[model samples]
Target chain A: EAGVAQSPRYKIIEKRQSVAFWCNPISGHATLYWYQQILGQGPKLLIQFQNNGVVDDSQLPKDRFSAERLKGVDSTLKIQPAKLEDSAVYLCASSLNFHGYTFGSGTRLTVV
Target chain B: ELKVEQNPLFLSMQEGKNYTIYCNYSTTSDRLYWYRQDPGKSLESLFVLLSNGAVKQEGRLMASLDTKARLSTLHITAAVHDLSATYFCAVDDSGAGSYQLTFGKGTKLSVIP
Candidate 1:
């Protein structure tokens, strides 16, 4: 089975600039998640979507970060006015259920 | 809020030695997941443990869960250099309405030859 796919494997942006990352989940996957992982730290949930509708986004930095999954398929995460602290790897994962999460390779963002 | 804690934070062992990493969580959950991540790579699922006393082994790595104690252990037997990577334990928080996972800080393993 094809795994979740993410692109732009790497990106560099200046502070206060805007950037977007794309994610294409596996076929038939119903749940998608976005996570932020900093250097030497665990992945932190940024948002979650269940078939094009948001399920949870309590931890998202709404002022600068926003995510959406349209048509219940591919999803996109955008960061506006990026900050230096936003430098980290953004991972996208998809799942059919709670137990089978398949993750993408992630996009490494370096904000200077 | 569900909190997951992994002990030792970092572990360095010599090849052919054995060691165990621990994970403790603060809430009740129906499943636990173990994932391995190599440097600059995505997370790879290792095991999914459900229910009390569930144990699963693959190759030289074994994982056990104790739901009654809210704990899980990943034991490495005769560790090899290939097994040197960061390991994370995530607990499923069903009450969170979406089966969201609460992940531990991760245990970084380094196996020396």
Candidate 2:
């Protein structure tokens, strides 16, 4: 059983630039989630998907952030016109149903 | 709104000592999860306490939940350097449908030999 996989362990971009993060969840997992973890803080849920459909994204910044899980197996989170406040670690996690969440290594974005 | 808080944000103790971290939530939840994360690393699942009075133990660590009190505790027995890391407690609010977790700020533990 492979763990959740994420791409681009680290990223650096200028303010107002666009950035995207990719996540490939573990096989057979039915739920996937994206979280933003600022330094010295807990991870905050950005979006959640059950299969190909979104379950919740109320906390997502509609004006700048968007996420999609097209085939239910992989997902992507994008931030357009990124801001300095958007510099944080983006973590992807997969679960059978909210019990044990297998997390990816995360993409650390640094916006200057 | 759901809020989770952990006590003693930082803990430093000698190896072989016993200590416990506490977690308190604002609302009712179906389950609570404990995770350990090393600096610059992803989180690792530690324990899941489901239902009131649920308890689980592994190695030198034990986790328990009290739904009525809306609290959870992670107890470390005879701690070791290997257990040094940031521990987080997350709650899954019932009826939220999201199954999204509300996490505490986390307790950073440092065990010295």
Best by lDDT: 1
Candidate 1 interface RMSD, angstroms, 1 decimal: 0.7
What lDDT tens digits, residue by residue, belong to model 1 across residues B1-113? 99999988999999999999999999888699999999999999999998899999999999999988999999999999999999999988888578777789999999999
**What CAPRI-style quality would you assign to candidate 2?**
high
lDDT of 2 by residue, B1-113 (tens): 89999998999999999999999999988599999999999999998888899999999999999999999999999999999999999998656666878789999999999
Q: Which pairs clash inside model 1?
A: none
Stretches off by above 4 angstroms in model 1 are: none
Question: What residue runs in model 2 are displaced by over 4 Å at the alpha carbon?
Answer: none
Q: On residues A1-112, what C-alpha lDDT tens digit does candidate 2 reach at each position?
A: 9899999999999999999999999999989999999998889999999999998898999999999999889999999999999999999999896777888999999999
Backbone clashes (count) for model 1: 0
Per-candidate Cα lDDT values, in order, are 0.94, 0.93
